[model samples]
Each structure stands twice: as structure tokens, then as C-alpha cells.
Target: MKHLKEVDAVTTELREALAGAGVVLPSLRPDPVSIAHRYNPPLVELGRCSMEVARRLTAALTPTRQSRGERP
Candidate 1:
């Protein structure tokens, strides 16, 4: 709960930016591994953020032509 607000804010911003750029990312859901057992909420959130961060970083590092809706 401590970082809920921060995480939600970040996720929302990421979603909006991606949407604006015509990029659609899959929603983050409880992992199947977590369903089979118990998992911490903070860690789950961290995982989602990790995924989003990696996605954004990858996109940012990609060539400008590819990122700008141009043929590579």
C-alpha cells in the first residue's frame, strides 16, 4: 500500500504515453505462478513496473524511424 499511489501513477502515465503513440500494451494481471500460491502485493506491483520499464526502455532505445511509425 505504501507505493500503490506511486505505482499507479507511473503505470497510468506509461499507458497514456503508449496509447498516444499508437502502441498497445497488454494489461498486467496476476501471474499464473502467483495464482498457484501466495504472493506479496508490493512485489506484484514491482513486477508490473519492471515489465513496463523494460518495455519503455526498449522502445526508447529503438531506432527513431521504427519508433515513429516508419518502415525500418
Candidate 2:
């Protein structure tokens, strides 16, 4: 719980820092597998959320934006 909050806080900060650069990262949401227990996600579920965010971030980077059909 504490760890997740920490991650969320840092993520929000990063999101703000990059927003001006046109790199809008997705906000982290509760993992679908653990939505019913939003406050207590298991380690594996947290990992899944992290991976999803990573995938989104990677796709948002300049090199991949053009491939995704957006002007880079």
C-alpha cells in the first residue's frame, strides 16, 4: 500500500514533468485482476500494472509515435 502510493506519487510527478514535452503517459490505474481489492493488490498484480505503464511509455516515445500513426 505504502509502496504503491509512492510509485503513484512519483509517476504523477513524472507525468507533469513530461506533459509540457508532449509526452503524456497514462495514469496508473488499479489492475483489472485486483479492482475489487483496490487497496490491497498482490505483488504480481502490481507488477502487471508496472509493465502496462512501461509498455505505454515506450510506445509514447518519439521513435514509436510515427509508427503508431501519429506525427512525430
Candidate 3:
């Protein structure tokens, strides 16, 4: 139907937007270990640390939102 087509179009647009934003959706055939091995452990560690800090900051900010009675 026309609605189905519209829904598909919207989904495709959302996927493209997420890809542009550097988010890769689940893929059935991910590249193997050889590619992963090329990544430097230090760089990976830095990214992990940065993500942890961001998560902690977000968690810390949530209390302020709660004090203001924000929904989340």
C-alpha cells in the first residue's frame, strides 16, 4: 500500500541519517579479526575512557534533572 511505501522510505532516510552521524546499524557480515587487529589498543582504550566519562557525566546530570522533576 501507499502507507507501507512511505514507511519504508522513512526508515531508509533514518538509516542514512544515522550512518551520516557515524552510527552503524547491525550488519549480518561484519569484517573478521584481521581488520579488528589493525586497531591500536591505546586508541581503543582512549575511546572507551571517553565514553565512560560521558556516561558518568550524563548520570551525574540526571540528578539535577530529577531535582527539577524532569521526565528524563
Q: Against the true structure, whose TM-score is highest? A: 1
Candidates in order, TM-scores: namely 0.42, 0.35, 0.36
> In model 3, which regions exceed 4 Å deviation?
27-72
- Cα lDDT tens digits for candidate 3, 1-72: 343444455556755654565543443122233224434221111112355445654564456766898878
For model 2, name the residue pairs that clash.
Answer: none
Return the top candidate by lDDT: 1
List where candidate 2 sits over 4 angstroms from the true fold: 27-72
Specify the poorest-scoring 10-residue window by lDDT in model 2.
40-49
Candidate 2 lDDT over 20-70, as tens digits, reads 554544544334454346566422222233665566556556476566689
Candidate 1 local lDDT, 1-72, one digit each (tens): 445554556667766776676555565433444334434433222233456666775775577886679997
Candidate 3 achieves a global lDDT of: 0.43
Of candidates 3 and 1, the better by TM-score? 1
Whichever of 1 and 3 has more lDDT, that candidate is: 1
User: Model 1, residue 1: displacement in angstroms?
Assistant: 2.9
